[model samples]
Target: MATFPQVDFLKEAGLKADRILVPSDADFVARQASYWSCGARSLRPACIVQPRSAREVAAAVRALVSARVPFAVRSGGHTAWASANTIGADGVTIDLGYMDWVRLPSDEEGTGKTVNLGPGNQWGRVYSELALHGLTVAGGREGNVGVAGLILGGGMAFFTGRYGLACDNIVEYEVVLADGRIVSARKDGDHANLFRALKGGSGNFGIVTNFRMRTLPLPPVWAGMTIHPKEAIPDAIRALKDFTDDMWSDPDFKDIVVIGALIQIAGVEQAPAYKKWLEMPTITTTCKMTTIPQLTMDYSQAKDYHNTWFTATFKNDVRIVAKAAELHDQLVKTLKAFIPDGDFVTQCLFQPFPRLFGQHSAAAGGNMLNIERQSHDGLLWLAVAQVRTPEQERFAYTLVQDWVHAVRQFAAIIGGNLEWTYLNYADRSQDPLTNYGLENILFMKDVAAKYDPEQVFQTLCSGGFKVSNVKLPN
Candidate 1:
């Protein structure tokens, strides 16, 4: 197979030898193995380029464009889907793990309202650093989630109810465009169009190096994972529904493990807002007074396993929730039969996607999600399956596909169906960009065309859902 000969273009760009890697290098194996999913870890790229800063990223982009080589950009390598953050030997992978830096507002031009984050910084490190300064940003609830992909794909944060999503909180982005120019995109900046598109636009426009995000004063949270037995699922669903309704309601919905309820009210052992879930019979409770960084670390999942995820949106309805529970039970039974041995874990989560959060996004300069257009308070369902073998992975894929279809079909029957999916939790088989609504899609496409006239990201840098309704090249 063609290998290093094709990677000479990056070397010809005058990149330091240490920044480029071939299969022969020991570091290449380590980098490949570092991905969160075994499927992504197994894809062997022709070469991997590690750029330290926006300028270095710009140089790599220009070289790839000049050579007309297919490429992919990765920050945290957290996406579990194959080729989402990787490429095969036919392409090169731009590994951005080296660009992880957090510049506090004081460290920047004294914009205390915002903090600058390098795309490579994981939420764990970002929160840890920001916590030291008594500040934080609306970011991924999982510590291991990368800084770039989450915001670019429309992140839902612990503070989403109060501050909106991570994308909504982004004040500016320092991006490396297709032409190799490193430009800053802000709501009122010259690249304002690009700025709005970058909010939930995924990787369609350019490689983002730095995310200047609005910061908030750090607050200790009353949050943690509360694991419940299958019997208590009804209580859990009722709690979720009530939580989404923002009012106290009768508890009656029951089936999988329920694991979250974080409130910003500090110094309180239990916020009344979370009394229902807290009252449920639990196997365990990590719920307590804690800071953002600690909460994220506590909730982060184990990586390096073969993982699959699927998601859908629906208005909060007890019947729909019950339908999902039934489907999940069947999926689990199928998985149990499929995997009699080795590591096998699965989760079906339903988080609140309140319309207020969408309205907040619109108020915060708007985003590609257009969630503000939502007419009802909703729940975003995420189905995650992790297996030990490729065969199990395939089986799990088909099983979840059926599960999603059944749930959507059932929701449609009950008038609870919604045409949206959370991009970050989506598997490759799902098309989240199209679900973002046609208006948002068209806006993102126009911005991509304006900022990247060559369509390099569309045609070469392959990964994630494309805003133009076209699938990413394998």
Candidate 2:
């Protein structure tokens, strides 16, 4: 494969704002060099272009296409893998970090309020800004995750129970095509075909420059986390089902409870004792919540930069929750017996999908989101396997995949409807497009061909969900 080659087009393209950042540029190298995939892995881009405006981004796209160089587009750089943001050999990078401006409409103006975010901006930053006006957009739970990836692939979060996935909330998107044309798209507006294709389509469609989101007035929603002891896995697992069943049945609970087990060696000399003593006791409780408060929660605390493997959905099957808990407990017990002293943490996180509770209670089209198309009567679960060590990491990842597969099987057995997969936390092996339904997937592919007839996005762009790639089994 072709590697990064030295290029001098950045300086020529960058005009008013300090947009184009070449490899040799000190600030560019330091700012755009690192990523958050595992533990701060760094890659050198041959050319890093920071477009201050959508026009600049369009120009950068044209330059890259003319050069025939492979390019990677980065917004928040919070993607779990390097391939999503890092540049290839001799390729250019369209880093959207410089785009962090938000515009809100005053309540008195009667013009529905909305916020425009740059791709590089994270959900946390956006949330903080939105909170100033007592508003909260349905966004990803992890504050550090970028707005682009989350929305493009159907964002999942605590508010999703009442609002729906992130993609479902978007009203319009400002995107630059593979052929260097910039266009605006909305649900039923001009360029609607491209807009529909971009939703849950990953970055395969094009580089989203600025997103025009539909916003909602914020409410005083309660939030909390209740951790069950490791030893209480059996009871905790059972409780998990009861909690989600209540939410699925009532739809007003608006509660998210997570059950996690912390297994770690205490010290060098106490490693063995730590393992023996740490027998599956429930340790963290991050689940008590009612309505949101005026002040925002510390966004930085949402994640600890640890590697996480997760899968989720909205279904009214309590058995899925119970099965996940049981499987997690079994996996932990198995690890304890085999490794004897391995350090690992496993969590079964459950949150309700938005629109499950009720309506937005505010004006429509405030943000560029679509929360109206959701069926709220369901429970969504995420069986996570997390660890810090390389060996433990591999094991945890494999174990989680196995558990999710088992859960999928169990869902089928229980006559549960299996739908879309959350794209942000999806594994490389999982097929998200299929989760969107065969009809939706096929429709997205047809729409994609209309916008990008040459398959420029499928063959050239870096990574994200691709509409043209998924082949359904007959």
Candidate 3:
């Protein structure tokens, strides 16, 4: 028999959110689509409640507590891997999608520059709104990824070199605690530990209803890929080394060079053959760029939507690239053994870490992110393999993992450590914080314990990153 408590107490608590989805409810099929976390394979919750306001959220939490029922909070349903969304056929879920209300806070600076967004507002919406101000925030690139997941997990953006992770730029968060109390936490305020844990530690603490982030100055960036034939693989690999080395040595040049690769159908049929796109000859060379809009001119032409991507970090040493390429060649050959038709899609992505990127300016006394917050330089490499359908998801994940592991092993051979995993783009099997080292890990766990002494966050919510819950080294 199920031991979980009943959620009927919600009615008396004055919490209204459409209707409570109980286990016997016929809408479970529709409700299940939102479980996109990495561990969604085994998620079966007892009930789901969609609250529209922060007050209702508090009321609902209080009701669940009164009934002694465990529940998970969800924003965009992007954190699919966590068991937090799943109620084990007897737990409850507090879905925040209904709370997607973005408005300019009264306390915002008079410039109308700073915007406070609801946790449900996706990055695309935020970008659209901020672009009107000739401004943008350093946010996730994907159009549909949620604001809550990214900010809570220390989101990495395309312009991180100029600003910092999404978490670093956050100004405030309106959170609902375990006891159903609503509180506003800032860089310097009461429950400062909660503010720090909210950044990068995932939703292991509480449910954040609204997030306040600093905006950035919008600029036309040089972006786009210059595709070359497979024969140019050797030069292309070497160019990866030279380009990263140059950026590291001359950090100011971070604007001039940002290189990444893609592998998929390449023809006018694949994407609209604009004159700029049509101009590239089928040859070997580096593609230089000057604007993002100009570069993504044919984004609608891309084939794969669920493009499999894995990232591995290499040391500041230039020799690591050459070593990585050698391993990359071996992995390519191994994968080729599976598909000899030469129709497979696989490529490496690399970015330079300039000196300016290391200016550790996180909220004071808040989330401690980045393993070596000082002068650590390396190429944040991504292995983007092709994906065409749901069936191919497993294959794509395996190939990406294999490539990252091989590259990390190669880095070890060249005297480099595989530290720092990007939260937004990393695989479920990857441990993002492990790269932060033991001292930082211990610090994060201590912070989590301080804010959530009852262990409500660590034991109840099983989604997102949990520093206190991570498996310790033997």
Candidate 4:
């Protein structure tokens, strides 16, 4: 219903009329309606701009700034937050779906047979394309996740123990800054500081157009899922803790254990211990050696419901896991009693964050996550609430917040509390950037100020976590 003043400016700046879609266009309506989360789908941007190249993105950015209109950039549109990658009424949205391109570079010496990825490409497509070459990159564990948003938010992968977080594996980034400058940022290049900040910095500095990441051999991996009844939760918690404790000795093992209404352990391994562990007293699914693309695709089915996520981190203590599992049961009971007919489901996942993950990041030019500073092995906990309607979504949000608070309090009581929060799994209310500690927060602020002096990203591009709110230490 609102007017978009920037439409004329964008057209005059060399953006073709066919590239811009207004509300009347069926394509624009379809794109706005199809989001991974219901909250993002409810927003209505004035117009959508589909830029096919970085130059077009630069022109759009310049036009939007000159017109002084609010805008948001969307890659895969997977973020759960309401307005994260989508814009509200009276704003313009720069959708990068048309820019989805994946290729291998000709100069493989300096870049080391790396894969060039567009921000618009999903992890599923990237893996499928690279799998043809017998190669893979450390990326999102879920195939449907977008390349740009996940990398910007510090991506976690099944190969994190072996290769590190997805952002750490990136060798170069082609970014379009707030002032319309296109630049390549690398570790040893002129924008080295910007390069480090972009790792786990959450789109605060610039809009990343392309990512060149180091590829690893795509050998067959032993991967599968193991499901257990509700009564087996305590055993699952104990096993997870034991696995985290032993990961220091054997970094080849990677698994994600969910302890909630039902217990499931999905993992990939190369050691014999994995097979022995699979033989434990529980119902196990088919475990076989498979390719990375197949393994990721197995878990890529999109949930047809409203989803919300909140996260926490704690030391790898069996007590913490047990207590969280107990709390999860109570939370589910309360939700069922309040919203009896609502199709609300809760998922609590515990992922291992061994010291090896940090070591890998350190080896590959340090990132803003600063996971290396953690002295002990830990677990990153993600609590997701899925509902069928708006009313259920409201209740789910409150219940998830209470659940996170109770877990943090219990951890503090046991002296096992941790300060870090994984950015990719964080909710809107949680400040994952500030949780990176005072030093990293200050460094991010400096990078944001240096590259974007006018704070265009902090102010105009008002999606995701912003560095402007990070406070320095006294």
Model 4 gets an lDDT of 0.82
TM-score per prediction, in order, is 0.94, 0.78, 0.77, 0.94
Off by over 4 Å in 3: 1-9, 17-31, 34-44, 66-68, 79-88, 246-310, 316-347, 360-367, 371-374, 384-399, 437-439, 470-474
lDDT of 4 by residue, 195-247 (tens): 99999998899899999998887766666677766767766777777777877
For candidate 3, report its TM-score.
0.77
lDDT of each: 0.82, 0.61, 0.61, 0.82
What TM-score does candidate 2 get on C-alpha atoms? 0.78
Residue 178 in candidate 3, Cα distance off native in Å:
1.5
lDDT for each residue of candidate 3 in 154-222, tens digit (9 for 90 to 100)? 776655554566787787889987777898988789867677767777776678888887766666543
Better structure of 1 and 2 per TM-score: 1
- Clashes within 3 Å, all models in order: 4, 56, 12, 0
> Candidate 1 lDDT, tens digit per residue, 285-386?
666677778878877888867898989999988788888888888888888886876368887788777787887788887888878889988888888888
From the highest TM-score down, the ranking of the candidates is 4, 1, 2, 3
By TM-score, how accurate is candidate 1?
A: 0.94
Alpha-carbon runs more than 4 Å astray in model 2: 1-6, 12-34, 39-44, 105-112, 230-239, 242-255, 260-308, 312-315, 333-344, 353-378, 389-392, 413-419, 472-474
